[model samples]
Target: MSLGTVSQAGLLLALVAAATLSGCGQQTLDNSQDVAAALATGGGSSSPQATERELPTFDCNALGERASSIEMLICQEPELAKLDQQLAEVYAKAGDKAVNEQPPLLKAEQRGWIKGRNECWKSEDKLQCTRDSYQRRIVELQARYHLVASTGPVFFACDGNPANELVTTFFETEPATMIAERGDRSILMFSVPSGSGAKYQGGDYSFWEHQGEARVTWGYGAEEMLCKPTTQDDK
Candidate 1:
């Protein structure tokens, strides 16, 4: 959860962008293994423990009596309801930390995120997609706001693509693994201390480097790419 020496202006801009931006790139997480493996290895078994947590409750009444299938599912589905509560609690904490001209931006960004989450209704696996959206957003906000203490979230700028990049943000959970957010999905990668550099790997993608440039692979069929130091900040 180290903010490090990230510039104030840059940080603000990044926060705004992250808050508002939805997943425009391709999201290919059909396999449940992607999430399970990542969570299992991403430094913890599940979410950070929130004791006596006052889970947030969604207003299903707002949707009225006749709600969409997704809306109904969120209300009735146990897992989705649990995730919704977790998201609420984490979001409140993040909002508290998001002061100093950051609240409005975060609010607007959250609204956009809600819109993005609703887009999950179009996916074939509606439940899983919605769950992934909530989980990833919660983790991102928690890390960005330093809710839970952890290690390096070192950022890397890939060779070609502008939007395509890598971030290794660690959560203080269990098993001591790290989560790498690449593109529209996040993967769990275990850290390997190699010589002077470091390496992280999961199911589809991998990241490795010491000091200079690092190599990143998108998926099994993807080629390794040389990436330069972008910033230490997750934004």
Candidate 2:
């Protein structure tokens, strides 16, 4: 990957994009092999030291009920403040866990979560075409980020260096029967809602660079994701 061998246009695009990559790490991971050791799954070997994990099962009905309360809580300014803090910690750890995760298997579980959400949305009348649009985005991300899919109740792990092993991260059980497996370099967010189990509208995985805080919500009567970032800081 020497600059000398690259075409002029390719070099130019890379340079232009580099400007926006201010937050990117000093070194980039171009291939999985280069990162394999750091990314390899322990082959189901449990490490007593490792404890943080995702939920093994989700009941859509129960999760949706929970969402109703969460939605209402998140509506108020104070609630959003607390949610941002809690979610910030959750993602800090989850992002790193994703790197060294069991690559093939984790992917399978991810796919199942997506499919379940899609079916739920399709059956529900409120979402209309929203579910289809979100699914397309998920496909784009899976390929772009080299993520895999799995059955429902999938487990996710990070494929990163062992020495640096994800140490400073937070883990929280996202109790949602309508789970949405998602995130990327730009944004990190996922949601599952009430009543209809995995069926609803607007709930979808979303990621975007240089964009405002966004949400993928589903169902009727404004049944959508609400990801409003801290704008004014209660000033």
Candidate 3:
């Protein structure tokens, strides 16, 4: 992959960290946390390790409407829409639970997939029998308890990737979620495809093949920001 600059490499490392952080039954992390520790430690582009890590930090709970939100997951194998939906349901349930149970107001961060429907452009697979079969739901977690927002495409992780492994296929699937202490609000980006198998510090990560699985990450606090439409013709 032709990464143009060191910053691009950093973004790839963040994505690597994102993609490498998922699993089954108390799935322990093997390759993601190194970047995690770096980001957590506040190390910026100055680290060489950041230059080589190309995978994304894997969390199945993030969701959004735009393609960039979910990054390469949907860009490559969008067939996992149904898988995304199941994961959305999980997050929806979790949000409901959190709202009803009303956990402590203390600051915290967490992200995971909840099975549900996308509030925006929801698409169905070509197979009529399997319409909505793919993971359809996507969400980007937030601090102060909100699963989705008026943002971009959401990402998720599930039990496995089914036979349908293209942007055209969609299958029913769920994902792993975890509530944890929040981190920096920096967004994760994709600098290289998961197939690139790019190596980082003797560790090459691969996540593009991951279908039916959702990935998400949560951070500690949130800053209330505002949004407004601007005129295209004006500077």
Predicted model with the maximum TM-score: 1
Q: Could you tell me every candidate's TM-score relative to the true structure?
A: 0.48, 0.19, 0.18
* Position 103, candidate 1: lDDT: 37
Candidate 1 vs candidate 3: the lDDT winner is 1
- Write out the backbone clash pairs for model 1: 43-174, 43-177, 44-174, 197-210
Descending-lDDT candidate ranking? 1, 2, 3
**Model 1, position 218: C-alpha lDDT score:** 78
Off by over 4 Å in 3: 1-72, 101-235
Model 1 alpha-carbon drift over 4 Å, by segment: 1-56, 101-103, 153-169, 173-213, 216-235
Question: Over all chains combined, what TM-score does candidate 2 have?
Answer: 0.19
The number of clashing residue pairs in model 1 is 4
The sequence of per-residue lDDT tens digits that candidate 2 reaches over residues 114-181 is: 45433533354424333333343443333233344322332222232222111111112232112334
The sequence of per-residue lDDT tens digits that candidate 1 reaches over residues 1-235 is 3456557767888988876553322233434557667656653333323222222276765878666677677765667777888888888998898886533677887889888888888999998998878877776677666688887766777785545677767766322356777778877665556666767666677777757877888788998888876763534
Candidate 3: C-alpha lDDT: 0.33
Per residue, candidate 3 scores C-alpha lDDT tens digits across 1-235 of 5657877999999988777664422254534666578778766564323332322233333534533323334333323443444545555555674764545321142321111222113333323322232322232232223443322222222223222111111111122121211122333222233354221110121123233332222222423111122222422
